[model samples]
Target: MFKGKNRFQSILLFILDLSILISSFYLASFISFGDFNPNYYYYSLLLGWGIIWVGVVLKYNLYEVPRILYVDKVLSKNFSAITVFIVLSAAAIYFFTSYKFSRIFFITVVSLFSFLLLIFRILFLYLVKSQRLKKDFRKRGVIIVGMNQNIQRLISRVYSRPQYAFFIEGIFTDTKLKGRLKNNHKGGLDDVKDYLLTNNPKEVVISLPHSYGDYIDELIHIADNNLVRVRVVPEFSEYLSQRFSIKYVENVPVMKFRKEPMQSLSNRILKRSFDIVFSLMAVVFIFSWLFPIIALIIKLTSKGPVFFSQERTGQDNVSFMCLKFRSMVVNTDSDNLQATKNDSRVTPFGSFMRKTSIDELPQIINVLFNQMSLVGPRPHMLKHTEEYRVLVNKFMVRHFAKPGVTGWAQILGFRGETKTVKDMEKRANADIWYIENWSFMLDLKIIFRTVFGMLFKRDKNAY
Candidate 1:
């Protein structure tokens, strides 16, 4: 019953958005040219824009409202969709069509549509809240059939948010509780079948730990016999650090502890494509001239190689030769000792390069070679990797993606020397967070911040 309502709401939202798009185009025409009648060319343009808008919004999951809706989330999603739709529409016009559309009409249409989408979404949420508050609202009855912290949290969330339209019919657990499960206790596990027959709830939610596998199976069987839907909330929350997801392979369910958006092939492809294009541009425009000057300076000022290559941990904990413009004087302890502020081994010229981040620019070649990405966890020296893997919790989890020239850790001031174990742990945690929550936009944001910091902000951590 809840699923049917969700489907209905999605369809309703889809129709409303398309209607708003059509209305916005005609409205823009009336405002721009003083007539509601638009040309056939304009109509065709409108059709194209409508299709692109649908695709963009669907990708952003705008048709379905989140259970906990925030104003910032609503605005972000709508603005993201609008930006993509307008960019694509403008690109299509510039490339595929010869007819020059009026800039005023295009801007007016997009502005009107964007304004209407935000207003209607807020209005829709208000209406839904108002309707759910009414006594006539039909909330689905849910019977919880287990006891645990997970179950307790679920109950609290449902009861606190009446807008979700769930009525906790009762809770059934084998465990004896005095105060926690007293009010809603319909009896123990043996009474569940009888209560189901009598009450006939819309759904049964099972939240038993793995130890109670037998009880869970029996409850499922009973619920199925009574023609009631069953949903299981896994009790493995204690073992996970973040939200988990289940995937099916050959009809078998597999639970993953962390959700990595980069696991998607489309996202991987987009990141790689951006990396290739951006790296190529850097090599062509910046590196073409800057490399010779830096090499000459290093050679004139130093006694060793201009570039430094060292073994570092890459994706999947594999060893790769990481490249960088040599930023320190040649020393036997280079591999074992990390650079510190005012280090004796760093040359005067190298200090300037390291401070300005010019020393890391040579990794553009690594990106071009497909051994590194534009933005990811910074690769650590082999010694640091081996040492920190044992010291830091989930330290190796950051190796799930290719190491980057500058990463989440570096931009957040976790770069330079790590004098203690806690510093390395902080860097690893940031890297793991990035791996689990990566997006193309996030990479761009990191790049922008890294550049901005390098140009404007003075980093005390950078040596």
Candidate 2:
């Protein structure tokens, strides 16, 4: 029933659990007598533990969280449920098992498992949150047709959660109910159609009493004409928060969507603050060391200056000089040359630095100076930008944010030379995807991926 393909994620989780179980057994044996057998008892314990953990997750509805929910909330619930399960499991084992468990081993295992579970949840949530934060991840906005207390509460909740990423443009209600709404009353119901036409809200939420159900046909007709989404906040007493599936007569099935939780202003402010602080610290601590080393290597190996600066586009299509350690020969015609697999312009040391992404270290200063971000779309050269803007669809849209030191495209194996129009097209696609779906955790993931790639030496595309 999962919306996304997460088989790899499931396998990773299973491996983590298995590791915890096996380590617990080994540690317990080591502490007691340094001897343990892989017998029926061990097998039974592993099976029982796995089943119990999975059952606990199911019972707590951990897997049923809305797609747009923030990473923090999902992880908090998962952690609380898992901790309770571990405690109960330990109690049961102590009372029923013949072999006495070592307290230290039990504690260690519990702590380790808890940590792994939390890490996995954070990583998974970050990935999902990243996707949801994208512009395309937005759900159709719904206007509550009434201003009752319930509808007002829903509006308040939706407005409070940024991670919910649902924009509530305004509310449309009758004159009588309009006075009751604390805020978000755009205009009367009569003005809704015009507003919908002008502002283009994605959906309309009918929050009126049961008596107004008769207008469902009228609402549906309006929605159809405008090609908008429609939803009903039912007044039924047995309402449950559950997802539904939609199928056409002769088409692939699709999952019915749900309204997201509201994000608070404080949360947005806090996230932005975190981004600024984290990006600055990375510039000062990590990139500072690597920048000069790469610069020196480039200067000595090639006749060029230590740093290369080129005019590139930034947020809102603003131009800025993006700096990097020069990786090519001096005075070469940049307009005519794009790096190839064995470019003669690349010095021996420059090629190694490029492969490891050390040449891009100077961009950290850009991030610190607020000229770029630690993560976003990789900046393109002015000539390349001008060229691609003509050839690629929505290429200029990638200038929605400051260029990143490293980016989603770079981490997803799209870095280095763009030899063909198709190659540049793929990178542009990834760049736009990153802009539409930017998130704090996704930035961290890209940073982590970049570091891992560097260590493993996997940038074959770099000249």
Candidate 3:
């Protein structure tokens, strides 16, 4: 009733990828040199190609779970893999030997191979999706162990995506729930062994909470004895989002509670470079002239400094001097006070700045100074940080990455005065979501939405 091995899919994809690579390389060679070389160096380069592709795919987790494939993500990763292969090939050929590699052939092969690989993946995913829609397609049998939110999510995913090759055989849990499938509920933790031998699923998903730690060994033994694959959903898995990543420390896999894209060196460099270039452009084109005019207005309309600096929470629980165009009269409650709508302290000009979010423009300098990101979780006043961290458990988690001037929370309408603890909690949730799902594309989307909102939308919360 079940497909023999899901690994067959990965193996097939691997072979197909290798064939595409080899064909691309040979076609490039024939087109460029008018002849194909089957020499030692050629085979060596092919071997290098294999190593690079496999390494990149494994490093990026291109083919980890067999049935749970993401074609779009795989497409993006394939581009990165091909790019890395090209650069590494160039470096290896440049230093190791005097063989003059044809730049044209290299270019042709790289482009063609990337395109072909992407096409293959796209076709494969579509085929899987469509084929699974048909009842006749062989489906990989899977069983869920334990009862938790993770189990519910797994059931939803498997049932929702019938196009995928996953066929849930049954569920095993100790909890008593009404109207569950017949014989699906195995007695308890002890019965997992007997269930496995009787119903050998190709994959078993263990979705128990931390309290079931003792049962893990038993389930593992059962799985091993039956030659079944086991997938464990970490305890309290809801604390982390879908993008949750794992890192091995001394061969122990540690789950990241928050997904910080900047944790990756490549992501960090890419973000920093963008911040530099963008901050420089803003400072030169916009700040160069706007600052003087805003200063003159502040000096004339208000009896305080043009820029207000206050302690704000930043990355790693560090405090930084956050600069903003002063929007209110100088007062003792400035640091701790939450600004409300139509506050008396707000100057006419200041109100306009706050309304348009022009008051936050100075934080471009913060981004330039590397104290903040252009898009992230918006920094809160130190007082708010301390208060909120007590009120909301995940409040300080936002500090895992640099705070931004305009952020996920702000764009989501969770910014400004929090009249209730729920408002602050919602903001904290949004901030954590941003941190967990940070990506260059997401940042761009947030930045775009912020700009659009500022231009067209009115923030009733802004005083």
Candidate 4:
């Protein structure tokens, strides 16, 4: 049986990607020189590149368009695809043709292809999202097979992100919990086999706790026997860290837990190198000239240092002096107090800076020194950290990466004073997500969002 139209979409994407991959090189060559002329050996090189790129894309699951709308995943996969293509292309040429390749030509081709691929993925996402909102849009049917808090969480998560386009057919629970009040509660564990037979769902998600482990084997047999995919959400998932690494101890499989991507040396190098390059650009281009004017204005408007420095928790719960352009009058309570909305201590000029996030410009220095990242969890004051750690589960997980000047939480309106524990929890969750899913392209996306956010309007809670 066909599992929806996703396979058809994947086929279409394969063809489109192949066309784009070839067109990018042709376009690059035309731009590099005046015309496009290729030898027979070069034609062979293009063929080899196409084959390798296609395989790489498949390896990275690039054709799975719905779940991975994230630009970071697309970019990472494309980068890997291009890398494979380049390596395969080089080997084929070196082993076959004596014709030398131009360095400029290769660089231009790779750069153009990367740029084009990213554009294609972004446009594709917009198209997918719009299409998914249509009344008649085709969505995969998923059935939840157990009763627990996980079922509620799964429903809320699905509702929160419509881009996935998965419709819950019905939540079939084994127990006669409060959830059975709904009309879709087709049956209990006894009726699950009947539900699977009747509903014809593409995927069955099992969320039974370990205490109900006996039902697992039966459910899997039902799901697998009927050509539906089975997904198990282990009960320990809540207690374990965000991500897992699978290793083979000889032939046996072992699972190791981890929090973020920055734990790897290569990832660390990529983030640090980008941080240096970006900080240099900001320090040289924006801050060099702009800082003097801002400093003068601050000195004239407020009786305090030009820069505000406060100790904040960073990666590994280490403390660092967080830098910002001073935007408030001198005060003794600054160390202990949280700035409330329309705080009396905020100067007129300082209020503008805070609203526009201009006071944060000085943190680029922290980025340059490696104390902060261009994107990561935004560090909190020591006091706030201490208080929230007790209130929020896994609050310290945010410290897995170097604190960033801007972060996913801030972009998503989680910044400013925590009016309630729920607000702090939301902020902590966003930070945890960022830490768990760090990528250079995601960092760039966050930075882009932050810049546009600051330019367009005042942050409602910035005081």
Candidate 5:
């Protein structure tokens, strides 16, 4: 039944997902309490749950993975998103305090919901494949204009996925050669226009070598007048790059180059929203509870204020005061000091705080205020920034985005004291690369790395 309109198929999938969530919630309540008592709190919980699930689906591209749907891929994506939502749900419950919903019910609901969604997707894929095999569906005919290694690979992949409903109309080579595959090579480059006009393909894949750069414009002009979708398979092996994105500047198309992936604008906004909301919650719930104890400890241990503020360069070269729990000797000059192993300036409690990263927690306020991100390049002191800007290439470019409390550099064992110019240079290089390839997945990876790095004492420079 899923045929023809792509928009209709997408809408159907969304409705299926919504149905799965609602049914799972109902089942979970029954499993937990043996009765259904829908209350205002239940309504609010369902609303929040739906928002998170939909947000995760959009963020992860779960709904846009081409035609063929693999059960494993669907389940893996669903589990990852559900895990994040579960964490967020727990945090919400802890902070709100007034919601007396059963924890068992929430966990059951999420687990059942994810399982049902996964099963539904698997069944849908199976049915679609079955229908395609038994029925004479109209397959989209595709033609490759150039015969190269990339084109050959594309042909092989498309041929393997029969359920994708794409028919290859043979590859056109530029030069004649011996031992050519039977019925594969149609003709030389000159016959491309004539062949297109005759066949009327739905799409054209242009696979050309990097050496054929000069001929790209001519090829584009040939396909420009046609209604068929045109795609280029550029020789990217020479670049050895990871991230690829297209952007327009003043009506001119430009490709963004980077070692890391670029985060989408929507995901960036979502992450920033998450940072603000969570930071505010931390300040209100956790920090408010812990401040008096921290202050008492600091006051008894040394003769300084409870908090220490430092001038650091944030996103776009904007300066901000980064706050931290006081973790050093009272009279020490902060400007010249870099915490080192066995540093006499650090008090007993201060040393513990530094090792545990508790001293850095107050910067949650900075995150909430938009002066910093939850993850990015670590902000540098103004003096250090000046010193490193000269030593490291593209060092100042890291300031293109907001700095973070913890960052790629910190998690990668480049945190803390940079005793040598080379050390600082390496750190700055990592920071710049991180900025160029920012993504929500990359942020999650960094957070994972930081947790493991802390546990294993893997960061030698953290002192």
Candidate 6:
């Protein structure tokens, strides 16, 4: 019943989107130009827009809905596609045209089309979910043929997202698993053939270690003979500590343990562009006036320079002079000792600056110099780096990306003093995770959280 369902849905969605775009353009023309009939130039513009829309739809893979679909995933994919389409349209208007298009009409059409597309997707998802709830939705029958942590995770994922429309028929495995996964296991691997002969499922998912190559191949053969689709889940959890992707180096397969978005030249350019623009804004708007005031206060309240510079680790395990507003008195122990709660090193105004995160504002200069990113793993002093490298596992991995003014660790309350090795470990883990899963959206999220926390939440660790 579910065969070719995705392709069918894709066709319907494409038709609906095209309809929305056409209706939007006409409606916009009527509203903006007081006529449904547009000029020849407008028709040309519409043709260009239609072509761009189709290209964008294909590029973002808007046609293929995953088996385990979620509302957020649906929305994110649509939003990305729409954003790219709008950007391309604007570029087209600027570079490719001498003819003047009605700005109001163009805006209205894009806005209306985007809104309608969003509404259509939401409605479609709601309908799919409703059908599933009523048991009117036909799910592809799937049989899992492994018993391990990865298979268990897959089972949990299937059960968790009922809207996915995948029904597990049975589980066939040789290994005996404990806990919640045990109930789902049917007969052993030997009985898989007999089971397939009797109760043929739509797909068989095989997740086994490399040691089971012969057995896994046999199982695949059996599934093929039974006219069932087969999927092999590689067991690399034991070897890989982070998210990995399989790539082909010529004819050889290579498993990359970490995927860094910043590795892409386009991503790096985007990040640097944003950093330059953001730092300029901060320097002009906030730091221009605030810097002098803070500097004067620190000079009067403390006995050292207004700006404190320390050698801290940056990307590629290199060291750079990290700048911050001096929040402490001149002392021999300043480099070696961490500031404790109500420590004597902190000045009267410095304590306030520390609490409000005003002291870190000078790092905006570092951002302008490309010594650090606006969001990443926070840089640590040389002493801390030396100590933590031996004490904490993967501590140095944080240096893979540029140090940040604020980071994932700081927002998650891993900031301030780390008195124990475990605390540093947690911070290191968060930094490593950020490096592995870095994205433009995630950087923005971390920045938002940092500002929000400074404004609303009190960080006891900030001292």
Q: 174 in model 5: Cα distance from truth in Å?
A: 13
Worst 10 residues of 3 by lDDT: 1-10
Q: Ranking under TM-score, best-scoring first?
A: 6, 4, 3, 1, 5, 2
lDDT (Cα, 0-100) at 143 in candidate 5 = 76
User: Model 5, range 296-322, lDDT digits (tens) per residue?
Assistant: 999998987999999998877888999
Q: Work out the TM-score per prediction.
A: 0.65, 0.48, 0.68, 0.78, 0.60, 0.83
Residues 57-172 of candidate 4 have per-residue lDDT tens digits of: 76777777645366567676666565556666667667877778765666777677777777887788788878887878777788778766666777767733567677777777
TM-score of 3: 0.68
Q: Residue 193 in candidate 3 has what lDDT?
A: 73
- Candidate 1 local lDDT, 372-459, one digit each (tens): 9989999889998889889999899999999998899988899988989999899988998888877665777799999998798878
Which tens-of-lDDT digit does each residue in 1-463 have in candidate 3? Answer: 1134656777777788889999998988888878786345666777877887787766766654446765544554555566667778788778876776678877888888888987877787777777778988888787777777666777767644776667667777778755544456656666777788887678888877777787787788878888899989877666654456689999998866555667898677767877899889989998999999999999999898889998989999999999999988998889878788778889999999999999999999899899998988888888888888898877788889898888888887888889999998898889888876666656767889988988999887776
Collision pairs in model 1: none
Candidate 4's error at 90, in angstroms? 9.1
Superior by TM-score: candidate 2 or candidate 3: 3
Model 2 RMSD vs true structure: 16.4
Candidate 2 TM-score to native: 0.48
In the range 92-191, model 2's lDDT, one tens digit per residue, is 7877788855566567656766776677677766776676567776554656665655566666687445566666667777745444353667887677
By lDDT, rank the candidates, best first.
6, 1, 4, 3, 5, 2
User: What Cα-based lDDT does every candidate model obtain?
Assistant: 0.84, 0.69, 0.79, 0.80, 0.74, 0.84
Q: Judged by lDDT against the true structure, how good is candidate 6? A: 0.84
Deviation in Å, model 5, residue 73 alpha carbon: 13
